[model samples]
Target: MQALKHILYFADGEFGPTQAFRRAVALAREHGARLTLMDVTIESGIGADLVKRFGLADDVQQSEQRLWALTHLAEDWVQGQPARLRVTIGTPFIEVIQAVLRDGHDLVIKPVRERPSSRGLFASTDMHLLRKCPCPVWVDREPEHAAPRQPAQPTDANADPRCIRVLAAVDATQPDSRQLNRTILDTAGAVAGRDDAALDVVHAWQAPFDGSLPGAGPVDHDVQLADVLGLLEREHAAALTALTADYRTRLNGGDTHLARGEPAATILAHADALASDLIVLATLSRPREPGLFIGTTAEDVLQGAQTSVLALKPEGFVSPVS
Candidate 1:
C-alpha cells in the first residue's frame, strides 16, 4: 500500500507494449518510480545436437535477442522515461517473481494473455503470478481497440471505452480480513486518485440455513429464518461501515453497497452494474501459513471478471517458488 517506488512490467512473448505497458509508464512518471521492462524465453526442448544442427540461437543468444526486442518494443511507449530492460530464460512466472524478490519490486504489472476460449479467465502464468507473486499483481484486460486520446486530459466516456470507474470489494465481517480490506481500499483510492475515477466499495455476506427448524412448524421456521437473516444483514452492514469509516471522504455517500448473496456472484454483479474499469481485491483473505493461497471467492471473481483486476496478497504471504 505504500507509494510504488519500483514497478516491474512483465511483457512476456508477443503481448507487450499494450495498455498495461503504457499504464506502467504513466504510473512511473506520476510517482517518480523506477520502472523495469522484462521478458522470459522458455528453453527449447530439442536435444543439444539437433539444436546445434539447426543453427538455432543458444540460450545466451536467445536471451540477448529477447532483451533487444523488449527494448525496441518499449521505445515508443517508454519515450525515454528511464526504464530498465531485462530478459531471462526460464518459466515466465517463476522468472518474474524471482525478479521481484531479487530487486525489491513493489508492483508487478502485465497484460492478460489472449485466450482462445472464454471458458478460462486467466492463463497458467497469470494464475501463477496472482497466486504466488509476493508483490501486488495487476493483470490488465487486453483492449479491443485503441481509443482516441485528448491532449493532457483525464479519460472520459466520450474519449475512452473504459468508464474510469473502480470497484473495490472488501470482506469486512471477519477479523482476519480487516487488514487486507484496508490494503484493498488504500490501493483502490490511489488508482482512483491517479486516474480521476470514481470509487465504489462493496461487501457481500450470506446467511445460510435449512428450511425447517428442529422443533418448529413451517410458518414458525420461516419467521425465525427471516429474523436471523435480518440480524445477519445488520451485523454485516455495521461491520462494513466501521471498516470504511476512515475512507468516508474518499467514498462520499453514494458509493458503498452491502448485499446478501454468494461473495463472488455478488461482487461480479455489483461491478457489472457500476461498469467498473478495474477491480481492486485481495487474492487471499483467510489466515494461513506462509505459502501460495488464493481464496475460492477470489478465484471465482477473477474467472468471472470482465474488467481489469489488481490483486494483492496478505501481509505475510510467501511465494512457493524458490
Candidate 2:
C-alpha cells in the first residue's frame, strides 16, 4: 500500500483549519510526508465589499497577511517542520479540490464544523468536499485543545497509538455491500498497519419493520416473532463472520464487532465505547434527491458520531469476485 506522501489542510471560518493544520504537520513529520496549508477566501461580492469597508485596501494583501500569520503559527507550533503555505481566493471547496488534484496530494484534512441549525446540515463546504474529493478525506470534529498534546505511550494497556482509529461501516444486506466493506477494510487496514494501530470492523444490523405495536397485529404473530428475530440474528451473524474471516487473517491485529439495533445508534455507541479516532463509511448510492442518499442510519451516524469520519464515495466499488 502506498502511504500518503502529500497532505492538504483546508482552513476557513471554522476552527477546523487550525486543528487540521496541526494534525497534518504532526502526521507529515511522523510519516516523512510533505504538507501544504491552504486557506480559501470566498470572493463573493458582499464579502469583497466587507473587506474593502474594513480598510483592507487590497484583497491580495489581506489574504497574504492571513496566510503569513497562519504559516508562522504553524511553523512555530511544529517547531522547524518543513511545510508549504498556500492561499487562494474562490469557492472554498473548489479551491481545495483543485489544489489537491494539482498537488497530487494523497490525503485532505479539514475540520468539520457543524452548522448552527438543528437539522445537522454540515457546512456546505464540508458536504461538497466530502462528496466529491477523490483522495481520502479526514473530517476532524473534536476541538484541538481537547486532544492530548503528547503521543500515546506504547504499552500493553496503551498499545494503540493516539492517531485516529478507523471503523469501516457496511450494510451487509446489499450485494454491493461486500465491495464497499472490503474497500473500507483494506483502506482501514492499510492505515492501521502504517501506524501499528488497532482497526475494528463494525456492522450495524436492524430488524426491518415499520414502527408498530407488537400485539396490535395478531395473537398468532407472537410465536412467529421469536422465529423471525432468530432468523435475522443468524443471517446477520453469518454475514459478519464471513466478512471478517479473510479480513481478520489479512489484518492480524484487527477485530470484528456485530450489533443488532438501529444502525446509526448501534454504530455510534460502539464508536463511543471504543473512543474511535475516525470512522470509514461507504455512502449509499440512491437517486440524488434531497435527503434521499443520506440513509436513516448514515444520517444519524454522520450527525452524531463523536469522532472523525471518512465517507467513501460509492463510485469506488470494485467487486471482490472478479
Candidate 3:
C-alpha cells in the first residue's frame, strides 16, 4: 500500500507524448511523485534501413528536431510542478524497461496504439514488456480528451474525483480461484486507496465446454446443461461474496457482478458498461498447474481493456485447509 514515488512515462509514435504526459503529470502532482519522461530512439540496422528505404534524410536532422519538440512538450507539461524529465535513445521497449529497473520506478505509463500496422512487432513488444517489466505497467488507452472530466461539485463523498473505479476479473473454476481472488481484491483496494478510487469486483463464468462445434443428439442434454449451470452460478455467487467481504470496509464504493460468458469478453463488456478507469487482476505464474497465464484472461484484459490495468503475480501465500 506504499505510495508510488517514481513513475516512468514512455513517449513515442504519433500520440507524441501528449496523453502519457498529461496522465503522468496528474498522478505525480496528486501523489507528490517524481516523473521521468523518456523518448526512445531505435538505432538498430533495421531501423536505419527503414529510414533509408523511406528516403529519410542522411543528416537525420528531422528526427532529432522532432525529438527536441517532444522533450519540450514534456517540460511544458511539468512546468510549475515538482518533476524530473529524461530523454533516452535506444529500442523503445528495451529503453523503457531499463529505465524502470535503473530508477526503481514503482510504475510505468505508456500509450497503446490500437491495431498498429506491424501487428507482429507490436504483439512481440507488448508481450515482452508485460511479461518482463520489473514494475507494474499501466497501458493507457482512451484518448486524453475522452477521459471523464472532474465535476464542478461533489455529488457523493464516496466517489472521489481522484478515485478510479476498478473491476477485478476472477475465474472461480480454477483450484486457486479463492487465493487469486483475494490477491486481486487486495491489490485493487490498495490502488483505489492510493488514487482515492472505488473498487468493483466482477467474476465471469461460462458453460464448462468450449462450445466450438454443434453437439450430437443426446437424450438429456438440456437437463444436464441446466444442472451444471445451476451449480456454477451458486459457486460463483459464493466466491464473489467472499472476495467482496475481504475489502468491503476499505473500499469507498464497491459491488460484485456475476455474468455467464467468456471470461475476457464478459469482463471487458462489464468494464465498459461501468466506465471503469482500471481493471486489477492476479496473473498465473505457473501454467502447468491450475492457474492463470501470461496470455490468459488477465493478459487479454490488459491488452484489450479500454482502461488501465494492474496485474499482480501470484506468490507469498499459503492456502487454508478445507
On lDDT, the candidate that comes out on top is: 1
Better of 2 and 3 by lDDT: 2
For model 2, residues 253-317, the per-residue Cα lDDT tens digits are 55788888888888888887877777787655432444344445666777776667776655542
lDDT of 3 by residue, 83-194 (tens): 5655555566777777776778877777654555421112444555665565666665544555443322113321222436877777655675576567677767776777
How much lDDT does candidate 1 score?
0.80
TM-score of each: 0.89, 0.75, 0.70
Candidates, ranked, TM-score: 1, 2, 3
Question: Among all windows of ten consecutive residues in candidate 2, which has the lowest summed lDDT?
Answer: 151-160
Q: How would you encode candidate 1's per-residue C-alpha lDDT over 57-129 as one tens digit per residue? A: 8777788888887777665455445689888888999999999999999999898885565655577898889
At residue 65, give the lDDT of candidate 1. 85
Inter-residue clash pairs, candidate 1: none
Task: Give me the candidate number with maximum TM-score.
Answer: 1
| Cα-based lDDT at residue 44, candidate 2 | 47
Residue 59 lDDT, candidate 1, scale 0-100:
79
lDDT for model 3, please. Answer: 0.63
